[model samples]
Target: MALAETILRAVHKHDLVPKLTRALPWISLLFSFASVIWLLMLPIDGNYRKSYISENALMPGQVTSYFRESEWNIVRGYRNELKIFEGAAIDERNAVVEGWLKDIGLKTAYHRLHDPSVQDNMYAILHAARGDDTEAMVLSVPWTTSDGEYNLGGASLAVALARYFNRMSIWSKNIIIVFSEDGHKSLRSWVEAYHTSLDTTAGSIEAAIVLEYGGDSDYFEYYEMHYEGLNGQLPNLDLLNTANLVSYHENIHISIQQTEGEKLTRNDYLTRLKTFLKGIVSLTLAGIVTPSNGCESFSGWQIQAFTIKVKGTSGGNDITQIGRVVDETFRSVNNLLEKFHQSFFFYLMLGPRYFVSIGTYLPSAALIAASFALSSLSCMLNSGFTIPHFLLNISSVLKFFVMIELSSFLLSTFLPYLVKQTTDESDKISLVNLILLSMTSLVNINSKFAFSMISFSLFFIAMVIVALLILNFSLALCIGLLAMPLQFVQQLLNSIEAKIKVFLCLFVSNPFFVVYITGGLYLEAFGYQNGTLNLMTGLLTSWDDVQCWTWFIVMLGWFPAWLSIAISCGLGDFKNQAPVSYIKKNQ
Candidate 1:
């Protein structure tokens, strides 16, 4: 025991904690670069694998789909009936849909939006006779989608399916058919009311399938699964895989949002990479910048929902194939004993059949965010790792962060209302940009100890971005990647030749330029508009429509971080500043 104690003491004598602490800064710096490389690898072919069923119970397309010729005639009849109400008022259209639901022998309900962002909605619930009334599934069909396409065929298909589902006794869960105007708006309100009000209750919805078909049903270019929900939330991968598998069994070609689900070729790496990037963009902008299908209304409710867009202009596919996909997919879900828990909830898709799970992609952002923590630790360690003293040193910088956040709050809150008074919202945004520049200039006035302030700011922003990364990958990662250079940028600021590069970096990453120039570049890169006007317009629209946090994230999150970097750079040299330093005592 004495010999063991001596050996333990000997091991303790060769302490490596100091070396590790000394290595923290370099490790943190290296991690930022490593994250960039990691992110780049995600788009490569071998980085992601083909998606398969993760849940053994989810036997997709194993059952027969009976939504064929007989119910199809009912689909046509309802389609014709809806055509009659094309130009009618919203209330009148809803009344007609409700009456049809009652005639079909189902319990129907109606909901009117208080704000009138969209029109009212009509829904029917078919309670299962074979099982207890505890859980349900939803089939939503919009009169006109947010995409501005008339979903007549989709609506009719829903009504027919409702009628067909009501007749079947095999259902173990209630089936709900919803008809809402403007796809997302009314459906969102209805879902809120459904969970909140007794009148709208139809058990707890476990899953939903939104039908978004439009144009002639004689042909379609492709079928798309609109799965992205509000704030970048996605339904379980099993649900997506089930839908894809069911579609395959029906001989239906399912296309992902960015690319067609064709067999991967040796030369299709560009297409795959583009799909990966586009998927990231969509996830990043989910609630704020991206338009929603009705399925998005079910987000955050634990109700896995996705939209089926049977798209076409003039092609050689029938719309009946969509009904079959929905039929078998729902049948698979109905067989589930409980909610989805086996497969991934967060993922990036390369194609309908390919995906990169959270495990594969999380490290990229995690490393970037983690770097700031290490940097903060290194700074604290330099001051003897006293928490109280570290907090005291960073207190003023925290206040400065608060001040910048206050400025952001003002900009985000007032800008939306103020933009309404302007002929163009961009003018207001430009004015805000100038105000931010003026505020940044004020922050640039040399503080007593800017290094500590910058370090604390880095830590705080890292905390914020880490939180945001959970909510929206695109927004958080973009801020993190941009913030990564600040550590290196501060060192280079003392050199005259580096100032030009510094200014260039700051100029391009400027909040306004990010919104205009970088935004335009992003849009153009993804085959969107080649100009900045649309980007600005999208921001305004998102603010007005859904109160999306693009503006808040820019002002509170990205802009403040940029200001800290700028002020640190502008401060020039840290050598002359007298900060309380750590001195290792003689042992």
Candidate 2:
């Protein structure tokens, strides 16, 4: 009893809250700097590991590919057939593709989907002769990319592979070949329909490969792989490794994020830094750009899928060789008696071979987020220790938080309806609504820096961090780094300098300004024009099609938290009163 009392007295006498408040700014800065350094070091040798196949059942490239030279003739025949449907209507094109699929002796069907747009997706299934309808694999190609270019060679090659697989008797899993119109939208509709009770015939999907041949080039110099999924989810790493293994054996070069074969020099600091920065940028933007492919649609349904895009003009592998690679991959997947469960699901690929796992990169985000939690705790502790009043203040804060969140929710839900009723220009609605909402937030700004409000903001941020880390570590970390300065800015609001506080709070906490400044810096660093607009468009497209959560996180989670702090700081009337002095005065 005496020892416990002594400990309590020591805690009370030292007053840990003041010490933490004084040290928090330094701590946050140190952590942020360290995180950047840690990310920069990830691409160095000994910091990352070479990827390997974890599933023992996946004996990749073990099959002797019988996809011979004759397949090129078949590819040409299908390409010629596709020429007839070049300018045909949607129904006519569907019929042609269906007829070809039926001619290959596969059960074919069409799914009509309407969302932000309308599309028709055609699919076929090759039943396994050796097994019942228990599991299946998907081989899909988009009818056209987002850029509105037809994937003629991709669809042709898929047709040829379907015909070839129909004759093979060694298959144990069924093959579902899909030709989706309008890329991501069509694939998303088909996957959703297949999994739901709407399509009872669709079996459990094991894995999927999406082929995207950009042009009718005689050959591709390399294959560029895309594996990011909706909301920053990734397909199992084993899938990527399996593809890599197959391509390696086929003597085809594989690229990631459009990066060609570049050898890494361990001792060259500049080379390593460049490589590391590229990896970081790719990871940060994965949700926006890389996941805008056909394969990402299946990720939400828990089916492992990725896109293999054929790139280059000459002096590389031909369509026949690429077909062989896919064939071998399917054969390896066919060897699987169970679902993929042996590889890392959470990892960042720096190159074709090197990768950093979750354990290595998660700390960067956690430390940044911790800074906010510490700041909130400091505020609560410095509020003075009148137990009943402190409890009462916390209770009041919770009620206020609930009210504010409910109001924001109602506004967000109804604002779209109001805009739709008022304007026919769908493109302008978002921007106008954003402006109106910003004006709404500026109204009735709270002029008091209450402990409850700060605590609530901190709580919201912590929840966002935890949820976002599970979805996308890069996004969560980026938001945390951006929002860290808000804590210090809030502290400054309690001073007498109203004009400076308003400037810092509005400029620093504004999402639009942050995005603009960051975008400008990005363009300057990379020497790319219109990079910001392209990035913003990609992010919006991903949200509309693939359901990427980056934009939503910014608009809903981070934006609202920052707005609350900004409003309080802008209108609050705390003149030359320190936090400790205010608490004592209240007591």
Candidate 3:
């Protein structure tokens, strides 16, 4: 026993922990950089394979679609009718849709949702002939797209599909056709109502398909499938694969991430990297921003849903053909014995046909997140080993930590309400100025160890990263990568030059600033003229409507950490001297 103890002591005394602590910052930087590079390389030809339907029940493109030239007249007829309600009031338009649904000999109902905005939605259930009303599928179409353009083609096709499917006797699962007034808000209200039993007539939704059609093109040349859902939730890979397969069999070109008609070259590394980064950015934005489509609302309910947007000009399938795609997809869902379990739920889609599954892509995110953990551990160890009074002062540091975090939480919770209540622009400006003045004057005017608060803040940020990773991996990865520099740069803030660099880094990395910059870039890329203010306002509205935590996490969790770090940098120098000296100097 004494020999064993001696060996253990020798091992412990070999300076291994100190060596690791010394090397951790460099190690974390290398790991973070390498992981991102590795992620960017995943879109290469050999790295990812063509996605296949993992669910055997989803025999995509096997059933021949009978939707032919005969349905084209019906689609055209519906489109003609939609023109009358083009600029009508919401109630008038919804009544027209409800009348059309009733004409199909189906029981229809209208739901009035007021999420600080009044909107009306219509729905009808085509109860299955062969089974109980235990399982159901959703066929949802928004009255307007996110761009506020009328989804004329989509709504017309949906009406036609409802009429066509009403005559079919082969369905074993109920089909609920929904016409939402607005894309995200109305669908979320409906879904929430259904789950909470507010809509007693609604059944359990198994899967959902959102149809979004644009342009006045007679023939649909291609489709864009948006699979990312709320909080980084993804629909089953089989669902996406099935849609791609059906599109291919129907002789329709399929695309994703709005990169329609852009062919990827397998041999070019830069092109592939661009494609990969585009996917990452899309996923990250989807998680951080509001729900882009109605399908995202279903994610909160654990229902697998995605949007299939039809795009084209002249030489492809028409509305009838698009309806057939929906027809075939629902038929496959009707064959499922249970919820989607055979395919990956977490994946990064490279294109309509290719994807990198969680197993292949998650390590990149995990490694980046791990870098923060390593840095935190190293910081704790270095402080404890180098500062003799670290233990004695830690209690006071923790008290300050708690106070800061609490203040941050309170600020985040009340600031939006205050901003919203301030109707006058001048009042809002004055309120902001007063708050800034009060905070600056009262909070840290004579405080010592103010710079040291950054270390504790980093620790808090590390915890937030871990929690966020579990909730939304893409979001966590994005934030984690942005905040990674703090881990390495915090120690170097002792010099003015280093402080300036750190301050700049923190400023650029602030979630609010990041959101503004990214929002501007996204608008520019997509050719939208909307400014950053509108985008930020829309994001905040989404948070209020859907209770999305993306905004809260940034404001309450990340922003406070950033503010502390910035304040620390501005206070002059980080006191990395012995904790005894730090405490004595402050006293």
For each candidate in turn, the TM-score is 0.83, 0.85, 0.89
lDDT of each: 0.72, 0.71, 0.72
Instruction: Tell me the lDDT of model 2 at 151.
Output: 78
Error of 3 at 34 (Å): 2.0
Off by over 4 Å in 1: 1-29, 43-47, 261-268, 314-316, 373-393, 417-444, 469-471, 485-488, 524-554, 567-587
Return the TM-score for candidate 3, rounded to 2 decimals.
0.89
lDDT of 1 by residue, 134-153 (tens): 89999988878645767878
Ranking by TM-score: 3, 2, 1
Lowest summed lDDT across 10 adjacent residues in model 3 is found at: 578-587
lDDT of 2 by residue, 1-587 (tens): 99999997886688754465556656656766776777777776788888999888989877789897888999888888886776776567768878988998999887766554556777888999986888899998887754356777888888899999999998899999887775565677688788773463547899999888866765878887877676667889998898888888888887665565454213244544565456455556654542256666887767888888887768657889889978988888889998888889898876666678899888777766776776665545543333354466666556655655665566454543443354565656677678757965665533333545665686578678877875788678777777766766545655565568656756775776766666667644544456666566555555555566666677678877776665555555555335563334342
> How many Å off is the CA of 108 in candidate 1?
2.2
Q: How far is candidate 3 from the true structure (C-alpha RMSD, Å)?
A: 3.9
Task: Please state every model's RMSD to the true fold in angstroms.
Answer: 4.9, 4.3, 3.9
Q: C-alpha displacement of 466 in model 1, angstroms?
A: 3.1
